[model samples]
Target chain A: MQLFLLILLGIGVLILQSAFPFYLKVAGVKPDLLTAILTLYAFIEGPLPGARLGFIYGLMEDILLGRFLGLNTFCRTLNSYLVGYAGQWLNPENPWAPTLLAFISVWLHYLFLLLPGRLAGFRYPLLPGIVNIIFPTALYTSSLTLILFILLRGGVSWKRGRRKAGE
Target chain B: MFPRRRYSLFLWMLLGGLALFLMGATGWRRDSLGFLEIAFREGLAPVQKVVATVGSRAYGWIEGLKSWRGLQEENRALKRELERLQALNIQLEEHRLENQRLKELLHFAETQGSDFRFVAARVIGRNPTNWYSTLTLDKGERQGIKRGQVVITSKGLVGRVVKVSPNTAEVLLITDRECAVGGLILENRTPGVVEGSPEFKGYLQMIHIPKEAPAEENQRVITSGLGGVFPKGIPIGVIVRIVTEPDGLMKKAIIAPFVDFDRLEEVLVII
Candidate 1:
């Protein structure tokens, strides 16, 4: 059942990614949907399941972008695992709580990818990108999460109703 | 079975990293990758078609609302420019030399028993989340574009044909991490490799020129055409900053790319 849920999560992510670029085009900005989804799922599931989902998500992205094939996978898996580990200390039940953690984790995820590239004497203008894009993105993503929280609340109740009727 | 999932995750990542390092180190570029690239293009073609169709319809409606006078003026300008190119064709060899010359040669190159003609392709995909600039063009094998063919703009060398499909190609811009152009400092006459500094801010870094090579600020860099991939003397960019090695035996510099990526409406592919 755990593996089944994980697979379902991945399928959901692929559909999201497939549909995301269009949404980005409409909005004129690329929101890191994978990052948002992975962070959210990592908080829901434990680190292990989260890492598995992250790996699958990353592979699909790397395939679609045709980039350094596994780079996205490695980076995303690392980010999701870190977020999952952090979830241990947070109250996922609180509506506002996971939003703060997601905000922090996304920044950490970007930082993890940036460090090795920077250490190689490549100057990544971290401050400006974070200041300009990251904060706005976090607020946007938080608003999105709030909307999602309300939506998912409905979805969870609907699922429970179907399950109880069948049982 | 203790933290078994963690162990597998670590193992998978390690193996995956090894695979990526191998691929990068070997520098494997293939025409078949064009299949993947073209699939992306075709997959997105409908979206672009819809956009272009809607954009043109809206434009046409606006044209009717605005005036026919503006359209007539643009037509006159294009005709005048066309005549000027015909005249320039008679006296060339000095300005836009590389593009004209390449096209002249392309008019003669074999392997296409039918002459390989040039066409301008629309810029579709710009590399997302990238400092290194790459562009995907919407023309491909159906147009007789092949591996190792050079792509250029009116200003100069854009990139080479790394991958091509029946309808599209992904151009590894002169600014890609693995793209190397045989280049020289026109003033100093020193030869070097212009490697894409992916981490560089929308530019390329020409690396490993000898210390004796005096590449100063604003020196014009052009392809030496040492390699058959890019024809010689195509303008690349002007040097912006020079990085010197500790021993001072060699030096390199960053080049501000001449191609205005944002406004890349059309580009002529050299067959």
Candidate 2:
């Protein structure tokens, strides 16, 4: 049941990412919601399930774009796995955890994504791409991560409180 | 514990290898979609279209409310522009008629006749990533849309179709780094290759102009029709800035495209 719910959440985020980000873009950059979600999930679930979810969601995005087929899959899976592995030692209850993880995950995600393409002879303006696209996107995603963490934490505590009342 | 650790290592290596292989196979060039990609894109396109429609409508409502005060001023400005255009239209009509008569007398063939068939499509979605500028159209192979076809709006050139499935097509916008077009300055007939600037968002750079070319700011640029893919004489944009190359042999001009890519809702594909 939890797996099903996660799948549903992934789909919802994908829909929001693709369909509505145009209106919400800041400086021609949109927040990377998948990175934030995967970071949060990896912190809670550990490396294996996080990697699996990343692979699934990343593949969906690549297939939808119909170009650079497995680029996102590799980036997201690796980032989620590393985040989840490191997450084993960190405390999730810390308010800054999600924000920090999301910021690093977005930077790592773009690095993994652009490096392979650049090696393949694609001429990308590395400095401008990092400064303009990557930095703003990471900052935006991290800010969003903070809000999402607060909301999720509230819901979890609310559920626990309800369970205690029933008991 | 030892066996579990080994299994996890093997799983990571396998997934990573598969991903790298897939990227190499599909990323280097414009490969045709595999069966799996086509199936997934076709499956998800309808849902994307519905969501995009609802989202755009809501956005339009909010923009309308926000701009209610400015509409009257905008309307008055448009009316003045319309009057000026109407006067210019009459003069252009007379010139066109005279040009047609001269062509008939000279036995000049109509080179542009029957060279184009446009397939109109709605913009349903955009590229989800910032790395590329692309749009998803509601029409595809069934509507005779093909790869490498030119996509344009009434305002100006948008881009070209890069990928197509049974029910959808993808347009690589002219703002994307990978896109380029053959362009000419209308005033001086100076030809150059226009490419999307990687360093700038929402702008294009026209390169390969000889240092001596008479291109200038505010001059209109149009398709040279040198490339067989795009037909000639389509308005591209106006030159906004010019810079001399380091070698001093060439110049590049910055262009602001006439199409509002952010607000594009519909496009016509030249099949």
Per-residue lDDT of A73 in model 1: 83
lDDT for model 1 comes to 0.71
lDDT of 1 by residue, A37-81 (tens): 777788778788778888887787767567567767887888789
Question: Which residue pairs show backbone clashes in model 1?
Answer: none
Interface RMSD of each: 6.3, 1.4
**DockQ, in order, for the candidates?**
0.02, 0.34
Indicate which candidate wins on TM-score.
Answer: 2
Error of 2 at A47 (Å): 1.5
- Deviation in Å, model 2, residue B122 alpha carbon: 0.8
Please give the C-alpha DockQ score of model 1.
Answer: 0.02
Highest DockQ model number: 2
Alpha-carbon error at A151 in model 2, in Å?
Answer: 1.3
TM-score of chain B of each: 0.55, 0.58
Worst 10 residues of 1 chain A by lDDT: A20-29
